[model samples]
Target: MASSDHYFYVLQCADNTLYAGYTTDPIRRLAQHNNGTGAKYTRLLKRHPMRMIHLEHFSEKSPAMQAEYAFKQLSKPQKLRYLTEHSSEWLPK
Candidate 1:
């Protein structure tokens, strides 16, 4: 069996706002967000069918949450730059 690790992910809402969060299962969590069963931030925004734009893996919840919080603190331009440069497609170091 695979060991569980937390993941920090960035989602692009319909209005193009970025939302950061941590989850053990990105796919299921994305589904929840789309179905309006996820975070109140996403749900209340009425930004359904969100698209995942980035993801980072962490061995523990603390680091995962820390990543989410850090991403959330970034300004829009900084967030966009971070996504463009540190995209999940590049893979983690």
Candidate 2:
């Protein structure tokens, strides 16, 4: 796969919660979450995910997982800030 195929993503659940994950394919991963086939955290959410709020691409899985790790350690407010500050400006809001 190309370097750009790896991604670190942030998802907003239906209940106003967030989930961070690393994936090679965002669309397929999002579908897995919606279908209850992703991470336990997402699968156990009160409802299906609302949308993916942010994504950061990586050339390797290690850095992508590192991003996911770092994102997970942030407080909710900080996470939101990280997303806004880190996401590409051209990405849809």
Candidate 3:
């Protein structure tokens, strides 16, 4: 795979909750969440995921997973701040 394949992403679900995850394609992963074939938590929520709100591209799965862990450790407010600050840098055009 290419160096741009890994991605650490955050999604804003229909219920206003955010979910952090790592994937090779954020868009496709979001689609999977919406289609109920993604994470077990998202699948159990039964709420359609709205979109990928933030993401950090990585060249390796380990790095992406590390980013995901760091993101998940942040409080909701901190996560929101991170998304707000990095929104322009990560979100797809």
Candidate 4:
């Protein structure tokens, strides 16, 4: 598949925090997160069963990484606004 089909996503951690990452397989990624061997942030949170709250697609890995970095730098309020605006399609059931 094309890189444009891949996405970087954020999950709302159990502690009400956010975890950012890039993956073409969000479902498998979520499993990895719950399994304690995903991103360091997810491992630290250890709050299994995180909810997929945001996702942004990129035409390439570089841009996806860039977006991930930018997301990480946003303030809590900004992040919340992002989630709010994107939730319609991004948020998991």
TM-scores, each model vs. reference? 0.84, 0.84, 0.83, 0.80
Error of 2 at 1 (Å): 7.4
RMSD of each: 4.5, 3.1, 3.6, 3.0
What tens digits encode model 1's per-residue C-alpha lDDT throughout 1-93?
544689999988877677889999999999999888898888865576688888888888888999989888999888877887989552221
Model 3, C-alpha of 66: deviation from truth (Å): 0.7
| Winner by lDDT between candidate 4 and candidate 2 | 2
Summarize candidate 4's per-residue lDDT along 1-93 as a digit string, tens digits.
Answer: 564566879888887777889898788898899888898778874476687877777768888888888888999888777777876755432
- lDDT (10s digit) by residue, model 2, range 1-93: 366668999888888788899999999999999999998888875857548888888888899999999999999889878877887542333
> On residues 1-93, what C-alpha lDDT tens digit does candidate 3 reach at each position?
365689989887778788999898777888899888898878965467467778788888899999899989999889878887888743422
Off by over 4 Å in 2: 1-4, 88-93
Check candidate 3 and list the clashing pairs.
Answer: none
* Regions of model 4 farther than 4 Å from truth: 1-4, 89-93
Where does candidate 1 stray beyond 4 Å?
1-3, 44-46, 88-93
Which of 3 and 4 is ahead in TM-score?
Answer: 3
Ranking by lDDT: 2, 1, 3, 4
